[model samples]
Target: MLEILYYLQGHQSVYVGIVGAGIGALAAAIALRRARVAVTVLEAAGELLEIGAEIQMTPNVSVLLQRWDVADVIEDSLVQIEELNMRRKDGTLDGHTDIPVVEKALGRPWWLVHRAHLHEGIAVTAKRLGAAIHTNSRVVSLDHQAGGKVTFDLCRGADGLNSIVRSTLFPDVRPDAKTTNCAYRAVIPYERIRQDSIAKELIQKQTMEVWMGCNAYIITYPISAGELFNLVLSHHRPEKVYATQPDVPTEELRNEYKDFDPRIKCIVDMIHETSRWALLVTGPLKSWSSPQKNVVLMGDAAHSMVNHMAQGAATSMEDGAFLAKCIGAVVQGKLSLRKAITLYEVERMPKAFLKQQVSFLNGAIWRLAHGPKQQARDAAMAPDLEREYHVRSSNIYGDPQTVVDVYGYDVKVHAEEALEHFTNAEKDEYLGTGIVPGLEKYMGWFMKLPANQPHSKL
Candidate 1:
């Protein structure tokens, strides 16, 4: 039986076992290797095929990608988002935000890339950095016994929503609960979109368009270097849990949005097929690390939230970066493994949970019913649209503070500051309670916003 390995000063390398080869896992592998730790990624799938279509890499994650030397690898594949249009169901523009201006303010570019491209880029980098990736190596059980030859000094779960590592670590925590929402995701070739005059007009500029309606919304953006147009249609669905249907009939999708704007309907009709996914969310766990401190969870395994905020993947990558930073400090003898794990959990868990709540709240705001509340939301956003840059707006994306909090985050600085605070504190106080006193003082600006308190219904 393979036992968990341990690191020694100037001796054996620390072995990190990562389950699931998604973006988070690959990212962690890359960061850990850069920290001089040995990494082995176990992917249950026979191949590393990323299932999703497009993902928005907000500046927060884009910066990390650049730091990991991943941006250049996928440079040609990234489409920079220039503008964002918020519209009503009838395609009437309610507001507009200059994405470039927001990007400028954040000091990084906002990127839209196909999931496959991003995954390939990260995987390539991880492999080049000497991280071993083994597909078809499903981990059915974890042996914590420490007698035999050790294999991994640490284990991280980036296995996504149905993470086996999460289940093994926190069996009593309820599994992910299916939200009353579902999304149909599809991508149409730009060539195909250009054939439709109306659709072609919509894609003439590299912009992301969001059409909001009663209890539903549609988002479209050009991705894959403007070669393809990605569409995400989120709507209320009966409460039910089911497997994702990849080959969802296009007709069914068109029928669902038949009442939308002509341009939207035109684009929907062009989709030959799509995939339906049930939006699921995991409630906050008290701790992301196991009691042994050897096994830990990150990414979707720890805090799976709705995709409304488009931060799921971005935040997952942040987890990888921050976790690697903590572990790096341990390898450097600046901190112990126990303190590193504690700092990782304490510093990351609240922020991730807050993101989960905010994502749900953003969805609620976007899908407000056609009533006074919806009108108020649009009315509140109108003034910000008239300005060159947003100060604050009802639209979460346009809200200046929200934009900064989500996009301006720097994981390296955050980890360094957190490490400093942990190091300065009485070690016994933190290690005994697993709490970093006064850590909330360093929370992102959005943590104090009223919007952070999601509706009770959520």
Candidate 2:
């Protein structure tokens, strides 16, 4: 018993090197740890600093964290929002949806939380599960090999948008400048506006509010257990520039949303700091894996899309889960590493592309300035007192059933099915070899006697 324990401790079922230690990387690490595979996460940053950003954790993503046993660590830090409200720039209600109703159809509650807090939770889970995460160890290059011992390292590219792995894999694939948008992000402390009567009243009740205008829109929600407000504004911008700098002049931000709702402007004025990001689209990769099939891309590296659908992180989380499941199967000898990587791509690309389109459409709808087009959009989303009626009236992007379909996906089951398929193929190959080889000598002898074998004719 002691010898076996020592061996288990000394030997890893598989060695995996994951680049980038963000939500997706950490989640992938933890998922592999659950399968008892040794994982090392290499983050470019020297330390995991608190990025003052907030993200919406839809039911689809929350369910996966729960499955991975890290939900408790983040539950206290999450703001559970039950409602989603959309309004015209003047603050008139355009449409609304009940998050709880969507949650019921999806089987998990939607959460809003600080990006840093969620990262910490995933890091903690990864550590507890025995995955080693190395900070400041950026992988500038990759060296992959197949058919090696279990102890050999398998590279996984969980790197973010500007991924070196992705660039090296497909040089021709570039983000289309026409499809890009610019986002202004801010996370303001609730204390900044607690003194304002209207702002205070607004934050008292948990809700996600989206104010829409011509060619731009704003999404604001409570995060960090309602201690802060997360605001994001995306506008159609043609510049291909990518810049993230703090202390961006307030006037610049205000200029973008100058004609928005007064309340939204008021909230924007309260923001002391902000980051300007050029949101780049990275979906429909020619392939998410290397030709060798020894290295695979996950998360943003695989399919980076705009945040219009509030699914940037959610889809990455799904990528982590699916990739981990496939890699775990390889570690357990259920599938070859190459086969697993192929299955990962086959199972993920179409789904990611669909999500990419939905997100892009959402952005287009939200950014409609004014015209018959905008009017038709408003008419289609005509709200009703009944939640079900309102949801049914909304388009595919806003409909609750779309949420259910996207969130209800179970990648683990799909991974198992993929492994079973390959398993059957492998079995058939082995059986064919065994049966045919046994008849080799007889085949030769029978062929020699078959020149005129009328006696054997049926």
Candidate 3:
């Protein structure tokens, strides 16, 4: 039996034990504390340092951040994306989408910021909201039995990719599968980019640019308030081993994209150091909670997906927001702990799984071979470029429906509606009867409307 290191309020009321102190964990703490739930986070690291490069915050999770009062803290650091440019391999613009117009429709702006700044802001907000955070406390084992000297109403696993909580709960589940694709990340100073005329044009636009080619693509955007430009190069590598190498040879990086546009080559030449990481994604799980319902998973621990859609962080933060909403119902005596967790899994699992598949598919679309199929994709997007109102396109960013589904979603509102449906079903004696009377009608209301529909606006 592993000893639980932290105890809250002598177990007098509902308490949550959270493992891992990443963005998901901190977001959970902030939301739960706002809901008046006691939380204690156990972090494995002795000291939390800056990790990762830039991250995109789509409206789906950005709305939650605003509600939690976190956006204000990191506002200055966030770069509001004005446009997204989709280009061919040689840097010819295939199409572009106006982010401000989309932002106006969605009621939230898509933001780009340094991952470190976002993490720090969430951490500060979590601590300020009265959540206790413990460092150097690695939880090797969790005691799930009740009536222990140290017990929790719930134990949440926000510990990412190699989640001990996920493995401990379902030991028979297979490990996450490594995709054939790998990505190299590098950051160049905006000042250096300004020296090159072609590259300088990129910074001036303040746009997120995606250059696509055969089995490969590059995404670049400004972060840290336009001081640094973040670049990510992703390509298929069937023979490469799956591991994270902090310093891959710069020559290897240049050679991989030697045939790409000269503008891209100029930027690549300036990067002296970069990291290569093998992309891995977890398969869909049957459930995100334990049989006992006291132990649950969130974020990458629940559904780790590739980053092609730039929704990994968005979806992870969305999980934290939705989970907190479900658990908050339990705190308010509106639902039992078991049912609350069930509602969470019921509402979130399918959505996360769909997003995972979409991310994989988006990669395939962006990396199509430079042939007829690629030409068709480019042709499909050409009309949207000239249209005043962008519709469905080969480029996911330009497709208004995908934008609404991915960026315009409001998790909190959806969670509340889910709770309402659950409570109504329970009252109508439809819960245990294997038939939810009003569920179909409720689901119809939940389905996303077309982009042109009035209800599509968040």
Candidate 4:
């Protein structure tokens, strides 16, 4: 018997409790509360900072965010770059995909939006919807109990990567990070990269372009409206990722990409300055929710894959929406937290795991580094990847149904389906409860391991 107010103190929500305040946080609060559940938000930092530049939102994520009514928040901050330029060594197009047609066919738009705006929008919306957002209030500790009573303290991992919450929940997975290469992340004024027609079209509208070269990969698109363009320029090297930020110099930015195309090189040269980090990633956490329905990891804390795929934030947000839908359905008597999270993992993990593979392929395409064997393999893959871009983009990529496969179904519809299974799955869930970790038991083999790794020096 916990006192509701005391429980409410330093916390909110009766159903989805003490969750990280990001996509998952908002989804839990908004979705659960909508179904008459109490939820609270806990953020280590106070106030949101829009740090990264343009992010690509695939149709699946957009489908969820639109239902959340926060799409406009991102829509305003985005420049929809529709064209994807696959520049050859000579800087000519190798192939192109029509963004408008893709969007029309998918029944959802592929968008490029500012990472910061999207963060703030979710933060603001969560607060408005009655989720307590503690900014600057770092989570100092976390303890997941056997009885499902998970607890934690704040003011830890507030400086970003050195997260206390991460250290607590995933001690084995905590970062003793290694730096492979350095990337300069910046959002230059539109005036810098907008001179050319292709670049100008990116600034003025929606288009996606990848500037590939022998030793580096620089991808840029519009975000924060046409006024700002986010650019990421990566150069590979052997260096140590300190337990702390290294004393990186601005000259390092210019020095790194000196050999790139004049346009991309200039974008780096004119960066005004740059921000850098040793890219870090962790293996998947297996599952997101804890047994008591009280705690879960979200956003970067859950999984931080390479930027090669361009779906990092989109994937995190999708997790948030799906998790939200899960908690909400359970509160509405449509399912249970255990079953809901199981279903959530069942649906979302496959997509992310697949994206990681596609991203590996895309990275190889950029470095022109796919080895001889892989070159032959890729020669075989071109038609399939292109076919995927053309045919599978509209429906979910897998499952039996053609009208809507597993991947493309609306999150709402999926939530309802999950609920149906939940009611019917009770005996199975009860019987299998000891046999597995809920719905995730069925997804054991769904995550296909990456077949190849990418290296710039290859």
Q: Estimate each model's TM-score.
A: 0.90, 0.84, 0.89, 0.73
| lDDT (Cα atoms) of all candidates against the true structure | 0.77, 0.68, 0.75, 0.51
Winning candidate number (lDDT): 1
Please state the error at residue 239 of candidate 2 in Å: 2.9
Q: Order the numbered candidates by TM-score, best leading.
A: 1, 3, 2, 4
Q: Report the lDDT tens digits of candidate 4 across residue range 1-458.
A: 00011122233233334434544455445554555555565555455555446666666666766766778666677556556655533344434555565567668766667766776777666666776655555444455553235333111111124544555555677543333644667777877567754434444555455666655777776666767767777666667453324446778778776665665655666666656666666555575444453444555565666666566666665655556666566545555445655676566655555544444444544665434533332232233234343221111111112113222546566556655665676455622112112222112112222224221111
* Residue pairs clashing, model 2: 214-369
Candidate 2, TM-score vs. the true structure? 0.84
What TM-score, to 2 decimals, does candidate 1 have?
A: 0.90
lDDT of each residue in 217-277, candidate 3, tens digit only: 9999999988889999998775653568788889988988988888888898898988888
- Regions of candidate 4 where Cα sits further than 4 Å from its true position: 1-20, 134-136, 146-166, 175-182, 194-206, 240-247, 286-295, 370-409, 429-458
Worst 10 residues of 1 by lDDT: 433-442
lDDT of 2: 0.68
lDDT for predicted candidate 4 compared with the true structure: 0.51
lDDT score of residue 373 within candidate 3: 61
Q: What C-alpha root-mean-square deviation, in Å, does candidate 3 show against the real structure?
A: 5.7
Instruction: List ranges where model 1 is wrong by over 4 Å.
Output: 1-13, 145-153, 388-390, 430-458
Question: Cα lDDT for residue 238, model 2?
Answer: 56
